[model samples]
Structures are given as C-alpha cells and as structure tokens.
Target chain A: MTVPSPIELVCPAGSLPALKTAIDHGADCVYLGFKDATNARNFTGLNFDPAQMREGIAYAHARKRKVLLALNTYPQTGNWASWTQAVDRAADFGLDAIILADPGLMAYAAKTHPQLRLHLSVQGSATSYEAINWYHERFGVQRAVLPRVLSMAQVESVIANTPVEIEIFGFGGLCVMVEGRCALSAYATGESPNCNGACSPGKHVRWEDTPRGMETRLNGILIDRFADGERAGYPTLCKGRFEVNDETYYALEEPTSLNTLELLPELARIGIRAIKIEGRQRSPAYVAQVTKVWRAALDKLKAGGAEGFSVLPGWMAELNKVSEGQSHTLGAYYRPWK
Target chain B: MKLALGPLLYYWPHQSVLDFYADMAEAPVDSVYLGETVCSRRHELRLEDWLEVGKVLADAGKEVVMSTQGLIESESDLKVLRRIVRQRAGGDAGFRVEANDMGAVRLLAEAGVKDWVAGPTLNVFNPSTLQLMIDAGATRWAVAPEMAGAALAEVRAALPAPLETEVFAYGRLPLAHSARCFTARHFNLQKDTCEFRCLSIMDGIALRTREGAPFLTLNGVQTQSARVHNLLGDLPAVRGQAEVLRISPQGAHTRQIVELFRATLDGSRSPADALAASREWMVEEPCNGFWHGRAGVEQYVAA
Candidate 1:
C-alpha cells in the first residue's frame, strides 16, 4: 500500500489562547510573533510576550506541533537591536523555524544562530525563482512564503526551479500589492506595514453617515459608501470606491479574501509543501472552523478520490459570515481580480 | 553633487518629449535617465526614440542612462528588458542602463556590462544587498523613496568605496506599481485594451483622503503621494551622503527646478531661499517627511 502525503496545515495564532485553540484543533504548525514592531501584526492586545512565547513553544513541542516565530518586519536604521534580539530570543526558545524578511536580520540569524531554521517571509517579496534562490543561496533559507502577487502557474514554476520548500497563502485577506514594499498606508496615514506593522491603521479609520448612506473612510478618503440597509466593508485604500471619471468604482481592488478551498488537489499535485491560513488577528472559533475544514478537505484529497472532494458550501458560507466584504475571490490563483 | 533627471513618469506628446530633452541639454543637469518606468502601455517614446534621445543627451555632455519599465508583467516585458541590455552593451553610444527590476540586473550582468545604475524600484534596503548589486556592476543606485535619511546614512557608510549614491530629492514620490492600470480603469478600460488615457493627465490625477484632503496621485498602476517632495533645504545635509540628487520630471517649469538644485548644490543659493523659490515650480504642495523618518505626506523642516 502507498503512503499518503501529509499536507502541513500552517495556522496563525495571535495570542496564547488562540495558539492553544489552533493546536487542539489539528494545526500541524502554528505561527505567532512578539507584541511589538519586531513582528508584522503589531496590533494592540495581541501577540506573545517572552514568557508567553516560551510557554507556547513548549506547549506546542509537547504536543509534537511545530511553532514558527515571525520576525518579519524590516528593521529601522539605527534601531535593529530589537529585531536582532527577537531572532536571538526565538532561537533560545527553540522555535521550529524563524520567519524573517530583512536581509540584515537574515544575515544575523545565519551568522549568530545557524542552528535555527530560516523561512523567508512573504514580506521579502521573493516574487521570482531567481530572487528566492538568491535568498536560499546566500542565507540558507529552507522555505519561502510566496508573495500573494504570484499566480498558481508561477508558483509551480518556482517550485520546479528552486530547492527550497514552497508555502502559499491558501486563505486570508488579499494584499493587492506585494507585502513589505507597499507605501500606500504610510503615504496616507504616516503609518506603514514595513515601519509600524499595520496598514490602513484603525486609528485613522472613520465611518461617517452620509446623506446617501454610511460612508467608510481611511485617513479621510472615501473608501466606500453603503446604501441604507446595505453592508459596509472595512475601509482599506485598495478596496475603496473612488470617482475616476463620471462614475465611481473600486480603483484598486474590490474587498475580498483569498479562499482556495477548491484548488487543494491541484496545489498538492504541483508539490506545494504547505498551505497557510492568514488571519492571526481572528478569533479562535474562526481559526478552528477554517482549520478543521481545510484539514478535512486535504485528508480527503490524500485518499485519492476526486469524487466527493468538493469544498463544503456551508464552510464557505461560515467564512463569509465571519468577515467577508461584498464577496470572496480566489485571488491570483485563478484570476487577477482588481 | 551632480543633477540627474529621473525618467518622465508623465505622458507627453512625441514632440514634447523631444523638446523636453532638447531643453534639458542646455540645463545644468549632469545626467538624464530616459525611458518609461511607469506603465509599458505608454509608447510615446519607444526603444528607438529613447535611444535617439539618449544620443542627444550624450552629445550634450550629459551622462545618459536608459531606464527599464518598473513592473514586468509578461514575456513581452522581458523581451523589452533584453533589448535594453543589448543596446547598451560595450559602451555603445556611450550610454549606461538603469535596471528597475532584478530580472534586468541579471540580463545586464549576463550581457557582460560592467556599469549600470540601480533604479529606485529595486527596493535596496541594506548594505549587503547594496553591495551585492554593486558587485554585480551597479555604479550608482537611486535610494528607494521611502528610505529615511538615517537609513541612507547607514547604507552610505557601509557601501564599498567609489559607488555613487543618489536620493529622490525632488518629485511626487513614486509609491507603488502594479499590473492594474488605475488611469485606464478610471475610464472603465481593461489593462490590455485600455486606450492611451494616461496622456490626458500630464501629472497624474490627484487622490484625496476620505476627509477630502489631498493625499496621493494616481498614474496608471503607479501610486504617488499628492505632495511633491522638494528637499531643496535638505540638500546640504544630504550633499555629502549622496553624490547625485534626482529631480523627477513634472509638467511645467522643470528646467527651473533643475537650475534651483544645481545652484543650491553649487553653494550659489541658500537652502531656505531655494525651498521658497520651489513653491513657484511645484504642481502641488511640498513634503519631505520620508527623508525625516516621518509620514511620507507630512512636511518636516529641520530646526
């Protein structure tokens, strides 16, 4: 009998409770980060303290679950000490891998603590195989989280060219531009993902009632206006509606999440090492439900029957109920939706 | 420090493009970076026209460099990159190339070219990456717009000697680029089939925040801050840090902007007076926050 290939389910855990919930719910691995600028999700009341991280890693290790530490933000000049310390701490805590993007931090990790495995964060914007290989050859990056800007065909091509394991965004908020490089948030609000670890930061967001309906705004620009009784999506710059000529439309990207539940088999066939679920700020219930659904779908796919392997419609509906905007998109996997 | 005219992000008539450089030949600028760096659909000046203009700039005693498209989305884009590297090989026409993407870096290096400019789009953030590019044959690199002055200082200190540094001293900072065309989409057109609509707005259309505050400018796939970054005052501080100051091409009064930078750099003008004089030449309000390590839109004057 042939052995079934186990698909690694890399789930996000923003807090300790979420980490425990994800591990208990069958996540093969859980990724989390510190509660500061050293990590990308530098939101208030989320992420781990040093004690919490050490305990979280121990708990996951006891359960035979992997823990990946995200130290992904680009370090500010003259202030790389905090990021370097985060890498050192992650190595001390015995993380399964240290996810990093900055070239200096990558070099530091490679030199200071060579034992800790390195995974290139999507924030690195390793779009091409050559770029990925450059990181791998120079810094010994074992795996790379592919940028959301790539297509499935491009992903397959990258996997064929490079020796590193490839992880892709199986589900989450869609970044219209490549991560770490976008300055739209900083240009508007003075805060950016690269510097402040947030985009369209909540402090600058306001929803005002207009004569037409509820108008959603970010840094004082109209992102969307909902009619009476209509739903209002989160006001991000890319998802905002603007008047280009005479008519108003979504100038950048329509509000959507990347849900690739239908393409699991094709992705697996193409030799993808892992699938990443992207909402670390989400609640444990949402994480549990999404993780369980993907786990079931992936297990069924491994059983070799394409029949009866359809993505559960109810699961998708549940995802929409949580935080979907007007709809969900397959993102760059199927087609480029803007 | 010398003056380098950055690629013309705006679309102009064929004659205007020729005329702009013809005027630039007489300007005080030391180098001129020619070609389209925003949208590939802009064909006002193709490879041949750019080369022709490059020859004109070269003959005018300006160091001419050919810049490639910032976003390479298709096989056709790669072909364009290949052609650029081939044309500039072996000191042909005495012109260099500015690689906007890593693919361009590989192609240029493969063509056995020894010297090229690293355009701002490459996102060079650290010393090692900068050194790697330098080793690969980058003689000069325009620091990405968002990198603060403090960061620039660190990279400058770490750079191998003889590598010239340039800063985006004056312009509407080019923030981001993508496959989608915001200018064409403004007219309800698809990217592949959009009519050449970007030509209408010589300076990209201004974008405002929800509170009706001018925030950024949208030019096709490239998003620019609405505030034009005029670092005329910061020139003296960055003078030692950067070898060249890049002045992005705008609609009107570009020659005057170039002259102001040159005069200030040459110590013939005061930074404060030069900054005050720039208000007459800018298309929008001015900002220098990215250089100050603050919000890109916020203007910070050194005390």
Candidate 2:
C-alpha cells in the first residue's frame, strides 16, 4: 500500500489551558495570538498575555508539540511599534513560527529575527502560487495559510507550483469573501481585519429581544433577525439576509462552518502540509473536542491510506454539535464549477 | 491635486467603452486608467482594445495606465497578467501599469519594470508595507477606500520616500470579492456559465436590507456598497494628504462629475456647490464616513 503523507493537525489555542488541551489531544501544533489588536482574534477575554504565552510555549515544547504566534493584523502608521514589538516577543518566546499578514512586518521580522520562521497569514490574501513564491523569495516565508477562496483544483494547482508549505482551513467559521481583500466590515462598522483585526467586532454588536423577534445589529445596522425557535448565528455581515431583486435571502452566504472531514483523503492525497482549525476565540473545551476528532481522523487516514479512509458517523455527530449555525459546508473546496 | 479617472468597474459595450474614453480624452482629467480590473471573464475589451483606447488617451495628452485584475485565480489569469507585464517590460505600450495583486507586483519587479502604481487592493495599511512596495519599484499607491483621512495623513507623513498618494474620492465602495460570482448566484446560474449577465446591467444590481435600506451591489464576483462613497465635501481635507483624487466611472454623468471636481479644485466652484451639483449625477445616496473614520454608510458632515 502507498504510504499516506503526514498532514500536520494544527489546532487553535486562545489560552494556556487551550494550548495544553490541544497538545494533549494530539495536535501537532497549537496556534494562538497576543491579547491585543496585533493578532486577528483580538477579542476580549481571549488570547494569551506574555507570561501566558511563555507558559503555553513551554508546555507545548515539553510535549513535543509546536506553538505558533499569530501577529496577523496590519498595523496603522503611529501604532507600527506595537506590531514590531509583538514580532520581537514571538522571537523571545521562541515560537515555532510567526503567522503574519503585513509585508512591512514581514520585512522587519526577516531582518531583525532571521531565525524565526514566518508563515504568511490568510489575511495576507496571497491566493496564487506566484504570490506565495514571491513571499518566499523576498522574506523567507516558510509556509502560507491560503484564504478560503480556491477550489480543490485550484488548491492542487497552487501546491504543484509553489515550494512553500501550504496550510488550509479545514474546520470552523467560513469567510465567503477573499480575506484581507474584503472591506464589508469596515463599511458598516469602521473596523476590519486589515486595520483593527476584527470583523463585526463584539463591541459594536447589539442583540435585542423585541416583540418583533430576536434582532442582532452591528453599528446600528440590522445584520440578522431570528424567530423564537430559530437559531441565530454570529452577525458576520456576509452571512446576514438581505433583499436583492425584490426578494430577501442570504444574498452573500448563509451562516455555516467549513468541515473538510470528508475531504481528508483527498487533502492528504494532494499533499496539504497542514490543516488549521479556524476558531482561536473558542473555549479550551472546544479545542479538546476538535483536536481529538481531527487527530483520530488523521491517524486513521495515515494508517489506511485514501482507499480505507472514511469519515465516521460519531465524528460527524461531534463536529456537528460544535458547528456554527448547526451546519457545515465544504465551502470553496468542493466547487464543481466556479 | 490632479483628477484621475479610475478603471471602469462595470462592463460596458465595446463601442461604448471606446467612446467613453474618447469623451474622457477631452474631459478635465489628468490621467485615465484602462483595462478590466474586475472579472477576467469580462470580454468586452481585450488588451489590444485597451491599448487602442490608451493610445487615444495618450494622444490627448492624458497619462494612460493599464490596470491588472484584482483577483488572480487560474493559469489563464496568470498568463494574461504576464502579457500585461511584458507590455510594460517591452516599453511598447508607452503607458504605465497598475499592479493590483502581488503576483502582478512580482512579475513587474522581476521584469525590471520600475514605476508602477500599487492599486488599492494591495492593502498598504502602514509605512512598512508602503516602503516594501516602493522598494519593489512602486512610485504611486491608491490608499484603500476604507482608510480614514487621519490615517492617510499619518501614513503619508511616515513614508520613507515621497511616493504619489491617490485616494478613492468617488465611487460605489467595492466592499468584497469572492471566488463565487455573486451576480451568478443572484441569477441562479452557475459561475462558469454566467452568460455575461452583468453586461446587460450598466451598474451593479443593488441589494437592500429587509427594511428597504440599501446595503450592497452585486457585480459578478464583487460586492460593492449600494450607496456611492463621495469625498467631494472632504476635498479641502483630502488635498492635504493625497496628490491625486480618483473618480470611478459610473453608468452616466461621469464627465459632469469630473468637471465638478475640477471646477471645485480650481476655486471656480465652491465645495458645497460642487457637492450639491455632483449629487444630481450620482445613482444613490452619498456617504463619506470612511473618509472621516466612521461607518462607510454614514454621511459625516463636519461642523
């Protein structure tokens, strides 16, 4: 039997407990961010402080697992020092890799801490192999997490052309738009992933229970409304219902999570170097559950190859419970035709 | 500040495309950006056709620029990008090209073609990214549309070199783009067989919220704000930071809008009068909140 490639299972860790949980549950690496706007998941009560980061890194290292620091947001002019300082902290903490989006930050990291590995964040919006190769050539970017905007065929084509390692989002909240390239959030809320590292930032969100129904608004703009028994997903602008051509519908995309469990065999066959879970704001319990399922799935795939791999019912059941909007989609991966 | 006509975001008829530039050649504009920067499947005008229009604009003493596609996905897309870069490298086009994506930047930099405009899609938020683009031979950059005026002033001040700064002064704010064609999805058609429906609609199809509030516009893969983003009222403030103010082409009255901006900038027309006159030419309500560092949908009027 042909041997299956070892696809790395990268999990999310918003806190030290999450990091330890991910590693203990068999994650090859756990990615987290600083507790500030320097990282994309800059939500309150989430992420790690410097002391927590040090402890998390030590724990993962002791367990023979890797820890990645995500300093993914683009810095504004005056606050440029904060991003650079975050990079410095990553190097000081001896992170396995620093996931970044800003080219300026990349240049600084390359020059100041040459030894630190750089992984281009999805927020960089490098959708093509040419762009990835260019980053590799310029700043020595070792890996790139692709934005969820490519089909399976396109992803395979990109892998064939670039030498940099490719990591893709395998599970979690889905961004219908091309990351870093979208400004929908900024249009409605005056903050975005590129500037403030948050989309539909919680500070601006208001959920009100009224006689009409349960309504959620972002910056005073109505995002979505749900009836008594209907489930209301996160008020991401893209997933909200809107009117088009005199009909109201989810004009962009519905609230859903990306689940590539069924595509594991194909993903492994295509030589994806890593599979990243999308929520760094989720709880430690979530990290534990997802890490276990993915680890089990990867282990089975590695031992049995593509022919014997199958997504078990129990795994799907567990994944469905944690899924956003209580539903999962293949997202851009399974597009039969663009 | 110079008045620039941004690349036509909407697909028009072949003759209309040529005629529009011909009319623009005489309009009060310093530069005209040509080529299809949006969907590659848009076939109304090819590179040769764009070159023809660019030559006309060039003959009219207008600085012509060939803009590349924003989202590069397929091999064919890359091939087209290479052709555009090659034109610049050969110096046969006699016009500069705008690098919308990093792939284009890599091609232009590698081809040793210096002095390209870094399109707004490049996401240059701070001085560091802007500095890197300059090192890669970028001589000018269009600030991202959502950038506030305060942030623009700060970034421009911190620039290592004196690169020309352009701002999206007027247009329907392009909020997002996806691999999935939103227009196709709207028509319930597959993306591969989209039937070029966008050509029939001059501007994008407007999408509104259930409360009848205009929210977005669907143009193939791009999702734009339903409201037009206007910066005419902020021209006095914009002049402090930006060297060029770009006016994106709309379905109608583009020349009039250009004249209004020129007249206002030249002190022949007051800013308030120009703002009011320009509103008569717009397709939707005006918003400048993004320029003022607020929600892009809000129209912020300074006291």
Candidate 3:
C-alpha cells in the first residue's frame, strides 16, 4: 500500500488562550495576527500584541508547533509602512512563516528579510497553478492557500503542475465571494478587506426587532429579515436574504460552514502540505474543540489507507455543534459532476 | 484625457454584442477593451468572433485590446486564455491584453508579451505593487473604483514615472465575484446548468430590500452595485490623476455618454453640463462618493 502523506493541521488563534488551546489539542501549526489593520481579522478585541506574539511564539516553538503570522490585508498607499513593520516584527519574533496577499508587501519581505519564509494568503486569489507559480517565482513563496472555490479536480491539477507547497481551508466559516476581489461590503459600508481589513464591519451593522420581523441592516440597506422563531445570521451581503425577481432568498450563498472531513484522504493523496481552519475571530473553546476533532480525523486517515478511511460520525457531530447556520457542507471541493 | 470603452460586463446576445461594438467603433473613444471579462460561460461570442470584431474596430481606427476573464476556475478557461495569448503571436494583429488575474499575468509573461494593462481587479493599491507589476510587464493600470481620490493622488505622486492610469467613469460597478452564481441561485438552478438567465437581465437582476430600497445587483456569478457609478461630475478631480476615463457599456445611450465625456474632457462642455446631459443615460442615480472619500454608493456632491 502507498503511504499517505502527513498533512499539517493549521489552526487559528485569536488570543493567548486560543493559541495555547490549539497547541494542546494537537494542531501542528497555529496562525495569528498582530493587533493591527495589517491582517484581515483586524477585529477590535482579537489578535496578539507584540508581547503576546512573542510569548505565543515561544510557547508554540517549545512544543515543536509552528506559528504563522497572517499579514493578509491589502495596504493602501499610506498604509504600507505598518504592514512592512508587521513583517519586521514577525521575523524578529522568530515566527515560522508570514501569510501575505499583497505583491508589493511580498516584494518588501523578500528583499528586506530574505530568510523569512512566506506563504501566499487566500486573499491573493491565486486560483490557478500559473498564478501560484507566479507567486512562487516572484517572491519565492513556500506555500499557497487555495481559495475555497476550486473543485477537487482543479486542486489536483494545481498540485500536479506547481512546485509551490499547497494549503487549503479545511473547516470553519466560508467566504462566498473571492476574498481579495470582493468589494460588496465596501460598496455599502465604505470598509472592505482590501482597504479597511474588514467586511461587514461592526460599526455599520444594525439589528432591529419590529412587528414585521427581526431586521438586520448594514449601512441602512436592509440585508436580511427573519420571521418570528427563525435563527438570524450576521448580515454579510452575500449571505443575506434579498429580493430578486420578486422573490426573497440568499442570492449568493446560504450561511454555511465548509467541512472537508470526507476529502481528508484525497487531499493527503494529492500532497496538500497543510489544511487551515478559518476562524481567528472565534473563541478559545471553539479552537480547542474543532482542533481536537480534526486532529482525531487526521490521525485515523494517517493510520489507515484510503480504502479503510471514512469520516467519523462523532467528529462530524462535534463540528456541527459549531457550524454556521447550524449546517455543514463539503463546499466547492466536491463538485456534483464528479 | 483619452476615452476607453471597458470590457462589456453583461453577457449580451451574439448580435447585440456585435452591434454594440460596431457602434463603439464610431464613438470618440480612443480604445476599446474586447473580451468576456466577467464570465467564462458567456460564450455568446467565441474567441474567433471577438477577433473578427477586433478586426472591424481596428479598421475603424480604434485601438483594440483583448481582456481576460477576471475569475478563471476551470481547465477549459485556461485553454481559452492560452489561445488568446498565442493568437497574438503569428499575425501583425499585435493587440495588448489586459490581465485581471495573476494566471493571465503568468501566461502573458511566458508569451513574452509586454505592454499589457493590469486590470483593476489585480489589486495594486500602493506604489510598490504598482512598481512590481511594472517590472512584470504592465504598461498601464486601471485604478480601483473604490480608491479614494486622495489615495489615488498619493499613488500617482509616488510612481517612478507617469504610467498610463485609467479611471472607471461609468456603469454599475462590479462589486464582487463568487463561486456560486447569484443569478442562477435566484432561479434555483445549479451553476453548471445556469440556463443563461443572466442574458435576459440586461442591466442585471436588481437586488432590493424587503422594504423596497435598491441595495445591490446580481449578474450571474458577479455582484454589482445597484446605483450606476457616474464620475462625470468628478472629472475635474481625476483629470490629472488618470490618463484615460473608462465607460463600461450599458444597453442604452452608451455612445451618447461617450460623446458627452469627450466634450467635457476637451473643455467644450463644463463638468456640470456633462453631468446633466449624461444623467438621462444613466440607469440609476449617480454616485461619486468614492472620489469624495465616502461609501462607494453614497453621493458626495462637490461645492
């Protein structure tokens, strides 16, 4: 029997507790961001300060676990200084790699710190092998995170064609639109992942209870309204219910979580170097629980061959408890044509 | 400043697209971007058909450039890109290609085709990235529509030299792209069998709030702003910042809109007069908030 490649489980860490919890639960790597707009998950209370980053790095390094800093947001003309400073700190703190999306920042990192390892963030939207290869050639990127839009066949083709290491989203909240290119939030709220490091930013979000229904609006444009006794989700424009052709529906995507448990064996077979879980804004309990389940699943797949591998119901149950809209899907990885 | 007809965002019927190009050939625009930049499934006009249209536009003294799709997801899509890049080789049809994605960038670089335009979606916000793309063979860049006027001025100032910059001046702004087709989902159909529903909705499916407020628009896999982004009033602000002003095609009054912009640029008509004349051609209320450093959909009236 052919040996299955050992896939790295990259987890998210929004806080010190989350980082520690992820490490304790068998995450091979944990990615966090600096408490600034340089990273995409630049929420108010989330992320690490310099002291926290140093401590987190020491803790993970002691346990032989890796730490990757996500410097993923696209910086405007005046904002490049802070992003490059974040890269400087990442290298200074002895972090394993920096996940970046901006080409200018990539060039800066490659030129400033040649020894610093770089991974292309999903926000770069490098959907094809050629795109990934260009990043690899341009900046010597060690790995590239695949956007959650490609089918398994497409992923396989990319892995077969490129020399760059491949990483993919294995679990957590899904972005319906292409990450870097999406401007829906900015069009409505004037804040976006590109310019402001936030989508559907909290300052623009409003929730109201009315006789008609529970209404969620972003920047005065009603995003979704739920009937009595209905569950409500965050009013991201793509996931919100809108009237189209005189009918109301989630015109882009229904709120759902991407769970790649079934594709673990296949991804491993295709030589995906890492699988990242997508919630840096989540709680520590979420980090620990999700990491434990994925760890167990990965262990089982490694122990057994593809013929013997199967998605454990118990793991799926644990993951479903934290799923968005309380629903889970294989997402775009398993195309219907296959 | 020059006028450029941006790549058609909507998927039109085969003859309708041909007719639109035929009319564009006579417009006062300096350049025309030809190709399906939005959807790969929009095969109403194949590559050969676009080349044929390019020949006609070239004959009419319009500089024609082929644009690649913004979002490429399949092998077939890559094949079409290769054909487009390769077709530029054998003949004197030496037309520039605009790359919206890095995949197209790599292919163009591999083909040794320099002097390409980096489409707005490539995300060059700072001078460093713009410089890198310049090194990677980009001769021009369409400034991101969401860029604040002040920030764009900063980028222009910091640029190593005066690179040709294009401003998106008209049409419903393309807000986002998705793996799932919003228009298809509206009809409860899978993307693979989307039934070409987007073709019928010329201006795109208007997405409104339950309370009857126009919020957004759905165009197959692409999401757009409901309000047509009109920068006719802000022409003075972007005059020196951009060398060209781009007008995305709408179904009606596009040629007339081009003439008004040309007149405004030539100082024959004032910005206020041009704004008033072009208001009739716009499908929705005009918004120039991005130039005024506000929400893209918000209208910030200049004093």
- Candidate 3 off by > 4 Å: A1-4, A336-338, B89-92
Instruction: List the lowest-lDDT window of 10 residues for candidate 2 chain B.
Output: B86-95
Q: What share of the true interface contacts does candidate 1 keep?
A: 0.30
Candidate order by DockQ, highest to lowest? 2, 3, 1
After superposing candidate 2, which stretches have Cα over 4 Å from the reference? Answer: A1-5, A336-338
Kindly list the per-residue Cα lDDT of model 3 for residues B1-303, writing each as its tens digit. 889999989888998998889899999999999998888888999988998999899999988889988888888989888888887644555678898999988888888777889898998899999998888788999888888889989998998798999989988998888777777778777778888888957788888888878888888888889898988888888897899899999978999999999999899999889999888888888887777778899988866
Question: Candidate 1 chain A — worst ten consecutive residues by lDDT sum?
Answer: A242-251
Model 1 alpha-carbon miss at residue A79, Å = 1.4
Give lDDT tens digits, candidate 2, residues A289-318. 888999999999988878989999999999
lDDT for A312 in candidate 3 is 79
On a 0 to 100 scale, what is the lDDT of residue A134 in model 2?
A: 87
* Angstrom error at residue A100, model 1: 1.8
Q: If scored against the real structure, what TM-score would every candidate get?
A: 0.90, 0.98, 0.98
1 or 3, greater by lDDT: 3
| Model 2: lDDT of residue A236 | 89
Docking class of 1: acceptable
Tell me how candidate 3 scores on lDDT: 0.88
